[model samples]
Target: MSYLLRCITCGEEYEPTETRYTCDKCGDLYGTLEVIYDYENIKIEKEFEPKGSIFQFKDLIPATSHTPIDQSIGGTPLYKFKGLLGFDELMIKFDGISFSSSYKDRASIIAVNKAIECGADTIYCASTGNAASSLALTAAGTALRTVIFVPSTIPKGKLTQLLVAGAEVIPINSTYDEVFSLSLRVGRKKGWYCRNSAINPYLLEGKKTGAYEILIQNDYKVPDYCFVGVGDGTVISGICKGFKEFYDLGLVDSVPIVIGVQSEKAATIKHVFDKGKPYTPIIEPANSVADSISVGNPRDVIKACKYVESTGGHFISVRDDEIIDSIKEMSRSTGIFSEPAGAAPYAGVKKMIRSGELKRTDSVCIVVTGNGLKDTDAVRSGVEVKTYDIDEAEALFL
Candidate 1:
């Protein structure tokens, strides 16, 4: 089976060897390329029990390399999260276990693998934190060099991971959007491979593997709804794409409604969704404790909005305080430590409950996207520190 790169807008097909991210005619950055698979030739005996890792579904993936830098990219556990806000059937897709402790590893692994296959030596991307760390780590495992451009205010925990991975980290005194734009320019100028989400269509192919894993792990049980915290809208888009592919392939009965959760400060996609039709993103200063999802201008807005609306889903935003509260509450209740963005879906769920949007009987799955330790500052701020002396051990115990 083989795959080709096709422009989602102009519908122009290109050989897999073509190295552009968008349609050559349209040149609309948001109108990015897509991975088109030749499904008829590929036959899957059983998607449930993959022979290896995500590569078991290699027929669907668009990469030429069967060998991955890390084989443990997929197969994350989907645990039953019982009795959350009186919902009987609630599950959490814990993707924090990805090699780099973030869901972005799904994309990084594929992007880096494709770069190596294409004979590129250096891979570049711009991220708030998780994407850069994942890309850096994956690139380090291979002979590829990694250059990450990040905002100066990136979390300390993620910054440490980038340095430890030996990637050339450039901290720019600017916002995420600025850093991302600069990365594109520099990558093009230096003839380096760009691993940025929404820019590289193969990244979505990798991320969509998580959705394939989720559906397979559930025994092909399609949930009524799927919730994800949206930053650049890549994750939700990938999940939507995966579900659609499975549904089309007759692997699943139906596709779940994908709900995109975003922070109030970073509600660019949400605002566009609410307006309907003329989907133009409005940029603003995105200030949120969930740094990972704090993007003023989502790169994959067009596809993300289309998928959510087509599936009868919604786009909702919660305040920074709400995100922090959800992080604390979810960590205590489920014993799953999640970063603010990872737990933002729960905040959206809370809003749904209050507004009567989500019912008590709806079977839903919330994607826990990243490890809480990635943003220790957010965790520390949520927890209260009490000073106790060894002499007053009784008080401490009490």
Candidate 2:
């Protein structure tokens, strides 16, 4: 590994010997720990072909020379969005259909690699939905002991995914915050490796693979803009970090204008962006169909604001009805089924077009984050699923 784990605050890079979970000096203020890479040795060529998954660009990542786990991750599709926007260059990078059906799988694979390298057999984590499925499915590669704690109100489909992955699923009737706090305490006492992004510094590195894959597929050219939905802001930050690496390596000319999408109901960042003030410590959370972006208190909101502001990116918020409609629109137009959170980019793109926020020539990419299967509650009502005998199944359609 040629990278140093750096604190977002002090700008001091730590050596491998000094690698700890968080920054030693400015742990509280930094808010996020960033992995700084040695970009000088990197040579970005237009001819390079990425591996079938994220590993295809291993040379561009901060992975151990001998990756401990060789599981399939990354390499999701980037499809063009049609009809709504007049822009010819807008595309939605599909991340929902990851190995276990969420962008979290990218992080899960790498997190598990680190855990396996450290020789941890048992793993535990707290997630509202997507991360739980990712962790369990990735951990199933080795079939090592894994446990997932999620909110009791999680979609039945997501819960079923965890069970099928051979993970011990525990539902806490409390909110995600309560479940997260309890899991941390229990995890420390039980010696289980914590897989939550709140505690893991390398988790960002894993999630950054989405950016890497897109760049690789596009011949290493960074898009003019990248859009993502924000939960705790880890995924958005991850994408930014990936582009930063390419820039530092001289692989790309400039970083993309990072666009953050949040549910209008939980539009805290939008409030900060619109009011032209520093973040307010307290904000109210409202209910929305995009439950994935429902976190009122984002752990990395400070970093998110800093990244967007420094890179000249903007935060966009969309209403719940718009999100639901975007999900259907994207599926119908692109044939890429996505959940509400996954369709968030579509809503943002539409808003941009109507407001004349984006130019016609700009090359843009939207980060669709979760599978449509995760929350069938929204789509199940409108779409019909038919069951028939084998003999009549094909004949009826004909």
Candidate 3:
């Protein structure tokens, strides 16, 4: 289980104790580090038995302790949909079933544990919604205090979750990029543990578990492609890392082509990917119905682009209307309700299929990142209410 932290930007390596966040030479988001395991020394069982929580993959995770604050942090179901979306095989990984009703719980649990392990009393994070709520929910009952900085545009449902979890929620009137910078500055001055998954390398380790679970659930059968909603790019990067780890371990034959789904209104990652260069912070404001993925300047853009490109996957952006429509379509077709951001992958899938970019014969897996209830207001137009009068109902029936 020995591992070293390697800077993704520069070829700098450091022991875990040397640097906890990023490399000193290339500071900031560009210096984001990744956990590099000694695969040769690591061992796994030939008959891999899928476990309930992410702790089952302790060997791959950075932490020494496998115990989690929330037991139901991982193991979300991978529901299959045959002939849906006109694809030969389509599967959705329902990650919103996590404790916080979002895929972020996977990272939050580990980040909180890391904070406690480091003897930190407070954890600071900047999120659009899901990550903040997930951190708050995971840090609850623990000695660590959660301080979340969110944009003013965050949905009420997510804010409610944060407050209920007792986290000190601060809604900034500025954009998510501004809030992220403010939180980082304040957290650093206060010496708090930064739990922002984009910069905090360890948090990515937790998200990778989802990829592990997907492969395990399908009996080590790697899908042809995986579509994930991208905001700050941590989730997709972590997923790619997970598939790579399994492939390194000789568990899976190949990794899936990971397609990052983004809202056209907030397509920072997509823009960066298309540019074919290092990430440069975007000044444009990101306004999208999918609040969770509306990030103008994603911190994990470097890793996200690198990992996706490594898998021969490309990024795709969908319209807000398409996202809203996909939410309803996915719900009605599969009985799984997802937030606008969560449903963006489905929208991307439809776009790809329509443009002939995706083959109908290929098997696809869409990682739904959050529950629809997280931001019900985003899909208000999709819901219909019928008020029935007893007399009218009876007369119509007669």
Candidate 4:
């Protein structure tokens, strides 16, 4: 790995051998370590092959070893919206096609590999659903063990996937933030490698591969705007980091305006951005249909806020009904079934257009982060079902 872990707060740099996830001097509860690449001396091939999804761009990632998995983690399709929802210059990155049916698969791939590289026997993390399922499946594929703590209120479908993947699932009767705090302490005490979002800098490296894939897939053209659903905000931060790297390497001339989507029920980070206030944890009862992107206190809010502001992006919050409607609209228009959180980006697009934040001529990309199958309850709520006999069905069709 041609990278070093740098503290985002203190600017202290450490060798890749250091396993610590936080700055020694920074007292913030959500400190993030960033990966600084040796871009000048790094090697890039004239013709790159994406044989192992993100690993195909192995030289860009921070892992020292390359272990291929059975399932691919990146290279999801970039499809045009085809004038869907009255937007012409819009595209969607279907990250839901991942093995775990979520964008977290990309990060899990790198986190599991980093675990194996560091010789860690067990890894632990706090997730609501997608992240846990992704980590569990990736660990299982790589012959690694994982302990995942999630809120008991997580969707039944995602919970089942975690258990079936053979992860030590501990569902706490509390909010995601509570589970996250407890998991961090327990992971440190048990000597298990913590793969928590924001804290694990390598995970960001993994998520950033999607940005690389988007640029490459679009023939190296940067979109005018990119919308992503934010929970703990690590995914968007990683994407911004990826685009920044490409810009520094002179691959792309400019970074896109990376907008963040949040459910109004749990839009703490969005509120902060909207008001232009100092960082403060907003703890409340967050009950949103888009459960995947519902977090009261995002762990990587600092990086997320900084990225969006610096890149000319804005944070938008949508109502639960808007999210549900977006799910059906996107599925109907694009034939891609997306979970509430995945559909959140579409809702953001609609809001941007209505509020004049996004223009009709501006190119856009909505990062559909997960599949609708992960949250069938939300999908079912938006769909209608009926059964009829053959004769009745034929008569209705006729």
By lDDT, the best candidate is 3
- Residues 1-398 of candidate 3 have per-residue lDDT tens digits of 68899999897998986126898998877898999999998888645445578877878887644234556778889999889998877999998788899999889888887787788889989998999999998888787888999998889999999999999999999999999999989998998999886778998999999999999999899999999999988999999999999999988889999999999999988888898876555555689999988988888999999999999999999999999999999999999999999999999999999999888899899999999999999888667898879998898879
Residue 149 in candidate 4, Cα distance off native in Å? 0.9
Looking at candidate 2, the ten consecutive residues that score lowest on lDDT are: 62-71
TM-score of 3: 0.96
Q: Candidate 4's residue-wise lDDT over 137-221, tens digit each?
A: 8888666778999999999989988999999999999989889999988988888887899878788888888888778888789
**What's the true lDDT of residue 88 in model 1?**
91
> Which regions in candidate 2 have their CA more than 4 angstroms from the true location?
16-19, 25-30, 64-71, 81-84, 272-283, 382-398
Estimate candidate 3's alpha-carbon lDDT, on a 0 to 1 scale. 0.89
Point out the higher-scoring one by lDDT: 1 or 3: 3
What does the lDDT read for residue 47 in candidate 2?
56
Worst 10 residues of 4 by lDDT: 43-52
lDDT of 2 by residue, 228-253 (tens): 99877788888887777767777778
lDDT per residue, candidate 1, 38-70, as tens digits? 878767655356324676676887665544455
Residue-level lDDT for 253 in candidate 3? 87
List the pairs of residues colliding in candidate 4: none
The TM-scores, one per candidate, come to 0.96, 0.88, 0.96, 0.94
Error of 3 at 359 (Å): 2.3
